[model samples]
Target: MVRVHPAPLQARLPAFSTRLLLRGVFVLELATASWGGPPVQVPIGPSAP
Candidate 1:
């Protein structure tokens, strides 16, 4: 029989990084919205597969 194991911190590192990246984007968007600047173009890095 196969047993399932919970993921460890090392395996979750990517998820943590992704969350941080999203948070950064959110903050940037909020800042731009508040500033009311002329349509600033934010370059998002390549997405993960």
Candidate 2:
């Protein structure tokens, strides 16, 4: 015999946050470019495979 489970119908928050973060980084880059300073590096997470 075999059983199957259904996935939960949850909000895709991780995907949403990823997109939001990327947009934020782009905006930050634009702001920093106008400042004429060295680029700041933010360590958000470890590198993935």
Which of the numbered candidates is closest to the native, going by highest TM-score?
1
> What are the Cα lDDT values of the candidates?
0.81, 0.72
Candidate 1 worst ten-residue window by lDDT: 40-49
Tens-place lDDT digits, model 1, residues 1-49:
9976657866899999999999999999888886876765655677433
Across 3-33, the per-residue lDDT of candidate 2 in tens digits comes to 5444332356667788999999999988988
Off by over 4 Å in 1: 1-7, 37-49
Residue pairs with colliding backbones in model 1 are none
Span of 10 residues, lowest total lDDT, candidate 2? 3-12
> What is model 1's C-alpha RMSD?
11.8
Give candidate 1's error at residue 4 in angstroms.
Answer: 20
RMSD (Cα, Å) for all candidates, in order, is 11.8, 12.4
- TM-scores of the models, in the given order? 0.53, 0.49
